[model samples]
Target: MARYKNALTKYYVGDLEEKEANLRLAKWIQAVEDDTDEEVEEEAYYDGDGTPEEDVISVKKKYSFEGFYDNDDPAHRFIADLEFEVGEDRKIWFKQERTSGEILEGPATVTEPKVTGGEASEYQHFSFAIAWDRKPDISKSDDDAGGGVEG
Candidate 1:
């Protein structure tokens, strides 16, 4: 038997611990995208220059979450909360699933929401971007924090 990625699955974003805050929101999410890039600077060494040295200056990561916007859904409240605290730096993790162990987490600020779709077939969607400053701390599990308790 083998496992493969499926379209039906949704990604999650929440605190460091596997909290239920965003767990329920994951169900209403329709799409997820992660963008990462490095800022590099090229330096010329006059002492012994063969090829210009390229040094990584910094890294940037942006996470985008898109979902249907239904005021009736409880997830809508989560959106309001995020919007209300736009400039605040909140610890957030991007996980494939609520139960999945592997995750990328860091301090991020929520951006303004973007809405689309006002047609009969298309869905009314709400999209937002979370901008992170530091490199993500990837964790396999809460127990990945070195070792303490046995389970």
Candidate 2:
């Protein structure tokens, strides 16, 4: 059996290859929750009672993580550049391999980034947030991750 650790997770910004990513120093990858919810309305009729109606209202999702600080890393640069994007047109992504050899990945938008360091503290990290519309997909490999994408 393979041991699991934060280092096993990989984060990629945009379409960049993993070689240029900084996930090697990852300390933690927090779970993201899709805020999408369903709306239900119940109306009383003058005659017999009726079943309540329901509707789904999709909402923005959120993803967060903490990793070693590396200003030169492309993922870090991509996250920093997101602050300057007025319309937030860019996308961020992440992938993690499970013991079963399955990979999880999806599209995301960076929402926040926090850098923390102190005197006598050699370990520093950059924690960031992202918005997602859909939950990531789990595949056997990167090439199979397109299950979430449609041609």
Candidate 3:
């Protein structure tokens, strides 16, 4: 078991190798998802009497700005597009050929959105452990070198 002195940090990310890179990418996605987004809430109020003297019951307004992309391939350019996007203009086109592994990039609002809807939601609580370049089973040239905090 590779022991880390502290939780995952950018400092240790430099050592990540191959598959581990993907794992780190996944973690970043999770962190992004956990972040909250800004939201706008609208509320209305009414009273039994027309005058303010009467009791008034109203709903408090709150908005959740939290937003997250629905996709299995976190590496997809959509996430990057959302970040680099100048404004929240919905118009955008994401042309991608997974089979050919080719992607053509364009402007966000300038282009039409090729992204679709009907993404399945993740239900119930789940736990995930990320693994990157962790072939602990395979022996390395410098076996103990950088296995943990110590090189």
Candidate 4:
């Protein structure tokens, strides 16, 4: 059996061009949540059987990130700036590197960050969600390509 550490996962954000220089590492992230929602339709036919048929109409993916606020971090700055923008005119590229070495990249729309109000003893924190503009591109890791290596 193979085990992986969550700390090894990496996240990044950049311009739509996807240039290495423009990519900013989101190292300040303390937690991340990936969500997938499926839209389904269920129908019951008047056949002899009393069973309902279900079909998945669509799938939506979103990632929510929470972390300590760092004013100096470029990725943090970029996301903060978007809080003032309206609509989806501005979109950014997002990339995720899993501990298993698989990669997922895609264009996404970021939501405004919700800053938490804490006591003097607590650190400042912010959380936001990014929704994929379309289906993300996934690249298999070398281990997965060679054989069955759990990610």
Candidate No. with top TM-score:
4
Model 2: per-residue lDDT, tens digit, 1-151? 2345433344455543332223432333343333433445556565655655444455454546665656676556666566555443555565545434576566655666655565565655567776553676766864443333222
Candidate 3 contains a number of clashing pairs equal to 7
TM-score of each: 0.61, 0.51, 0.17, 0.78
C-alpha lDDT values of all predictions: 0.58, 0.52, 0.27, 0.73
- C-alpha RMSD values across all candidates: 6.8, 7.9, 20.2, 3.7
Residue 75 C-alpha lDDT in model 3: 35
| Model 1: per-residue Cα lDDT over 1-151, one tens digit each | 3333434334455664453236444545677677666899988887866678999988787767787776666555555456555344344444443234455555555576655556788887788876665665665766433223233
lDDT of 3 by residue, 49-120 (tens): 433342334322111111233355453333334443444333232221111222222221222222333446
Query: Which stretches of model 4 miss by more than 4 angstroms?
Result: 17-25, 45-48, 141-151
Q: Lowest lDDT 10-mer window, candidate 1?
A: 142-151
- TM-score for predicted model 2 compared with the true structure: 0.51
Q: Where is the poorest 10-residue window by lDDT in model 2?
A: 16-25
Candidate 3 global lDDT: 0.27
**Residue clash pairs of candidate 4:** none
TM-score, candidate 3, is 0.17
lDDT of 1: 0.58
For candidate 2, the clash count comes to 0
lDDT of 2: 0.52
Residue 56 miss distance in model 4 (angstroms): 1.5
